[model samples]
Target chain A: MKSVEPIFNDGFAGQPPAKRALGYIEDQKKNGKHVVGIYCGYAPVELMIALDLTPAVLCAFSNATIETAEATLPANLCPLIKSSYGFIEKDACPFYWAAEAVIAETTCDGKKKMFELIASRKPLHVMDLPQLCDEPEALDNWTTMIKKLKGFLEKTFEVQADDEAIEQAIRENNQKNRLVMEMLDHSALENPVLGWAEMLDIVFYATPGRGKLINDTLEKGVKVLQARVQNGYVHGRKGAPRILITGCPTAGDAAKVFKIIEEAGGVIVALDSCTGMKPFSEMIAENTGDPLRAIAQRYLKIPCACMTPNTRRLFELDRMIAKYRPDAVIDIVLQACHGYHVESFKVGKHIGERHHLPFLKIVTDYSPGDIGQLTTRIEGLIESIER
Target chain B: MSRSAGIDIGSRTIKLIVIDNGEVVVRKKRPSTYNPMGLCDYLLEGVSYDTIVATGYGRHLFKNYRKGEVITELKAFAVGAAHIAPSCGTVLDIGGQDTKAITIDPKGGVERFEMNDKCAAGTGRFLEIMAAALGFRYEEFAQEARLASRAEPINNMCTVFAESEVISLVTQGVPRSEIALGIHKSIVSRAINILKRVSTGRTLMFAGGVALNSCVAGLLREELGVEVIIPDDPQLVGALGCALHGQRS
Candidate 1:
């Protein structure tokens, strides 16, 4: 294999400019800029932006802090929850330190319960997320929750989230989402301009800031992708099996699956998770006159597995499979995550029966111990696709 | 006239198979100790084949050293099982460190599969440790289990815990054959659970080193009520599958 050249250089060099990004948050905090840390995509970022506060995703993605987190929580809990608590307990994560408050939602049981323990350490606000998203009352309940969050933000930061500010934030966030979508659209091309690793690096680098900063960075990324496409700079295996990754949010150590797939000669073309296209694929409605309700509607339709009768996720999967035309779909279910893990059967059935595509569900955690096994499974999928 | 070779460098044992014109010309198996590559060299010493494919746990290492193409054990087992028994719909391979249950499609492609996680609970290693705990040689372990009328019912599936459990059972003066039957039942139950997930067809082709244990095979047949087809050389199935790929390519 030394003599054989690697088909793709999957070096995930995107570190999210940690020191600088964290320092920026701290400097902003010192200047009376409140930062609200959020864990799930269900939390509305536009609300934070409307309140003149920076909203940062505080979901920990690595296993480094998991051991520490397991001390306070059960070892069998979701690694994401443990990692987050571990960082909070150790005061390690710079994002957690920079945040003045945390705005979390009742998404998964592990996180909802873990947030209670974390509330003692920080001024944490939990929003009751209605699981029956398709029901008529869910929108009203979520809108009320949004209003509640707005009220909390107003009281905590002493800033009024007026209708004008909320609308403006919505518009700005919609524009940022558009830019992100534009950047991700490059992968849909006949000759994909972006490799999965490069796409992740660009997305991760562009994510950690205010709407304008994120939009500007994403705009540059789109331009770079456009330029690459124009120059005919095709990357990875041209005819490689296109893989669509769905399930739990992937970043940090969880991203090893993506790296392994690409390294094993499969080109990852679409990501259906929160950290990927889910956040950007949908836009908040502008000119609707009720900005908060619009935000509620958009975030509630996230198609997360936590929602019961999550048929919308399958609908979204159908749309993604049709759009991306992936040869295979790999669902990365985090260990101990009952939501995605149980829902994997539905996902596999939909992908296989409906789309006639191969689906592989990988139940894993934020550890490097399963790399060999993961490689075998992922490579087996790729081999099946190739044959 | 050209011959193709496949080497399955499994965790416990390495198997090599050479095929020419759809006939297996050579088949070999040896314990893969500290230096598997040296043992692989010994296996390939007198073999003559045009192209080679590697499979199993150490496939990538063998691929790197020998410049042979590599295929995952899932595909290898599916193809090998299909080749051996065309009507076989499912395959269960309990290797040294891992266990895999795969359902083969109508075209002999891998339809769906489930592999054991990073733990060695229901693998060959688990049975080996339990066999040692019962003070039975590897060959006599299955024979002793076959003689037992009923299993002692081991509650633990973890290899380490099960070993201790076996030791305690011995201290309590439980029959060694019954404990041995209990270990077989434990591993068989784990395999059955995995088999239920991906299995759609009634015909199961059991392959791997574990298939040699008639006690386990008989138990699987009784529990699953499916036609259990054990190949002539069960350990060489993965290597045979790899050789099949070499022939196609």
Candidate 2:
């Protein structure tokens, strides 16, 4: 068994786990195996599994500087690009420097520009998938993108991704994704099988190429959690208002907000975050024989708040609300996150008018120390919900 | 007396204010669209000024308008805040698309400024998103936010994740007022952080569309432990600054 090494920004909340993933990946590379770097929420882990390559999801560098990023990208571009440019500028990650190939998608304007800029700097094959809200055309576009990505992967990895190999990868990935979904479903049960923090860690681990291993760990963890739930070992005694959280990457202060809610007796039933559900919920199409098409389909359909000029996002929210039946909604939009803020208000109003549910909007930065005020707010919210 | 006009072409709206003898006699706001020239002409109908100064996101795009003197939004904001509140030293301007913390000298000269131009977390746009999510018009967001009794700190930096978190809270039946307060507090914290990054002085003034939200301003006061000075018309600070720039230039 090859070890995986997870290398990421130290500022990321779950640095220990990210390091573990990086260690595993490093071990695999030591065995002369090729490592693939997947940027953002687009890489199909299942396809990576099928290709027998180690998948390393690249996150933005925390210490990125404007001076470093300005060498390759325009100053007016999104910070995500500047961060990526900073990574190349600093030569921080070996995976970025030594990867066999890099993969990305046109998920949003920032990501689209990121793909273009990164490709210009390095040799990368990008998949321009249609906007997920477009439905029929989105599926067709996604399928084509997947086929092209598969060809690129085959050429880059020099692996014979024959029909058998592709099918096998799809099946494994489907099972892995199903297990993950099942785990999330289990955690959201009347008596949750997993703790909120543990569930978040599970999502993070499942993201990189270590989905298979993480699924195995979670399977065991779920068994233990199920027994505990059956035995009534849950911490909170009072019935809490079930809730869902939506926001961008919960890197810094954002994660603290979740802790505040759970402490205030609000059970997080679902999450719609750039770093959490959006990356994991992307499932490969079942019928698509081409792996790249499967990847593109997953990327387009994954619900993201960053999709500008995308109205169909409301329908996605409606579905999640129905599934979770949350008593209320909270929007944790950061100060400068324009896309999510726009969607947050729109969705908050939609849920209020249509579902007749209460809506809460909270804005935050990347720090956990601000949880004191947050706790009071969540406690008050729970009390109001009870009333 | 010489006549001059200052126009702010923002991502969401266009603001035009005409100044004569250091007084703003005419002010107009129009939705920003594809044609910058057309919008400028429509707003400036029947008005002729000697000099025009352009600022904001789309300021550089208007080439035909008066060979205008262009100034960054930061400088324009300081000029505007100084005119409205001469005693204010720290200016916090939360616009439609971005948020900035500008520290000014006693004379209203910009000492230093920190801006969040990359993301949409603490801007007017974030409030608009929350308003839309709650089924309220963009105009009513500040009022709704004012109704908040307590603010639950939302922990996500990305707007997308934060919206989901907000939806989850609504589904759980959190009170509208508390949620509103929480949103305001979050934005205040972000603005405060930006202020800390640049320079922390005294007499912080809140400007831009977000300045219209007293709850947000109140939260800023609470977080920064300073009194926030909100002018009579917070939205016009940028244009007022531009008009003032016309007089000074």
Candidate 1 CAPRI assessment class: medium
DockQ of candidates 1 onward, in order? 0.62, 0.02
Model 1 clash pairs?
none
User: In angstroms, how far off is A61's CA in candidate 2?
Assistant: 7.7
* lDDT for each residue of candidate 2 in A125-189, tens digit (9 for 90 to 100): 78775654456777786667667777787787787576667667777676666666666665456
lDDT of every model, 2 decimals: 0.85, 0.68
How do the candidates score on chain B by TM-score? 0.97, 0.91
In candidate 2, which residue ranges exceed 4 Å CA deviation?
A1-15, A61-88, A94-98, A132-135, A210-215, A235-237, A263-265, A282-298, A306-312, A334-337, A363-383, B1-249
Best-matching candidate per TM-score: 1
Best by lDDT: 1
Q: Can you give the lDDT of residue A15 in candidate 1?
A: 36
